[model samples]
Target: MNHWLMKTEPDELGIDDFAHEPQRDFMWDGVRNYQARNFMRSMQPGDHVVLYHSSCKHIGTAGIVKVTRAAYADPEQFNPDSAYYDPKSSATEPRWDAVDLCFVDKFPRIIPLSELKTLSALADCALVRKGNRLSVMPLSANEYKAILATTNR
Candidate 1:
């Protein structure tokens, strides 16, 4: 199965929020970037995802999410009043896509980016890459294993 990393602001929907959800699942929406949209398009059911909490203290990977639904049109993209609206995107040719995700696990202590910088195995991970700001990215098998190993789980 494909491995992926999805980052969200803790204030928006972090690990604790996911864990507290009734079904532990939700549509991962509001991504408006083209590259991020393409990554969602590539996601598939059962794909393992690293749920990272970004734009918060010690931004880094926090937990795991399972892709429960593949790419589908993001309804918010069509609403002009929505914060994620894309004027160029149409219902027939949507410019955005999103996937449903199910919370699977969380690290006891956050595997912060400060610590991730020391791992040679994750040297190529997009999350660790300099100037990288995409909300969603792919993770290599080795990088995924190495990062998870460092977490308390």
Candidate 2:
């Protein structure tokens, strides 16, 4: 299965919110960037995801999420009153998409961005790259493991 990291603003949606939500799954929506939309379109059910909390005091992968549903038109994009509404996206020809993510577990503590930036192996990680802003991006198995390695350290 493909691996990925999906970012969410903590104030908007965070690991704590997922843990409290019924079934711990939420429809990831409102992505506006073309690259982020394209990445969602490539996802599949049963894939793994690193749920990262971004634009917060501690930006990092805070939990795990299993892709429960693949690509679908982002409902937010079609709502006229929605802050993420895109007038250009039609029901028949959507310009945005999102996936369903079921929260698996929350790490005891966050693996902070500062820490990620210091990891030699993660030097090539897009998550830590300068000006990197895609909300969703692919991750390799080794990268997944390397991040998880922090949980036990």
Candidate 3:
């Protein structure tokens, strides 16, 4: 299955929030970028995900999630009251999508971005690249393993 890294602000919805959900899952929404939306479109049920905490006190991969559902039009896009609402988007031709992610496990502790940058194996990781800020990004199996390896130690 494809591996992906999805960033979320901990104050909004962190790994713990997902775990507390009745279904232990939540719809990943509010993605406005085309590239990030496309990443969600490409996802499939059973795909693995690294839930990274971004724009927080401790930015890093905080936990794992399993894609429980594939892409569908983001409900938030149609709600005028929602911050993610898109007036240009119509139900007939929506401009955004979302996916359902189920919590897998939170890391023993955050694998800090500073630490990731120091790892040669993750040098090429988009998350580590300067000025790269796409919330959703792809990861090679080895890259996924390398990050997890840090938590094991």
Candidate 4:
């Protein structure tokens, strides 16, 4: 299965928020960037994800999630009242897509971005590349394991 790093603002929907959800899962929506939206569309059920908390006091990987559902039309895109609504989009031609993700495990402690930059194993990770801002990015299996190893240490 593919692995990915999905960034979210803790204040908006942190790992804790998912834990409290009735089904401990939520639809990942409102991705306006075409590249990011495409990444979500590429996800499949059971794909692994690293939940990264960004734009927060502690910017880091906070937890893990598994894709519970594949790509589907993002309802928000068709709702005029929603912030993510696209005026040009219609029910028959949705402009965005979303996936369902289920909480897997919260890290014992956040794997800080600063710490990530120091790891040689992740030097090539897209998330660590300068000026890279895509909210969702692919990660190699080795990169995934390397980050998980940091939590164990």
Model 3 error, position 82 (Å)? 1.1
My TM-score estimates for the predictions, one after another, are 0.95, 0.94, 0.96, 0.95
Model 4 stretches with alpha carbons more than 4 Å out: none
Superposed Cα RMSD, model 4:
1.2
Error of 3 at 121 (Å): 1.9
Writing each residue's lDDT as its tens digit, candidate 3 over 5-53 gives: 9999999999889777636668888999999999899999999999999
Name every residue pair that clashes in candidate 1: none
- The list of candidate 3 runs beyond 4 A from truth reads none
RMSD of each: 1.4, 1.2, 1.1, 1.2
The model with the greatest lDDT is 3
- Clashes (backbone N, CA, C under 3 Å), per candidate, total 0, 0, 0, 0
Better of 2 and 4 by TM-score: 4
For 9-114, candidate 4 gives per-residue lDDT tens digits of 9998888887676366698998889999888888999999999999999999998889999999999998889999898888888889999998888889998999
Candidate 3 has its poorest 10 consecutive residues by lDDT at 18-27
The candidates, ranked best first by lDDT, are 3, 4, 1, 2
Error of 3 at 76 (Å): 0.9
- Specify the highest-TM-score model's number: 3
Q: What is the lDDT of residue 112 in candidate 3?
A: 94
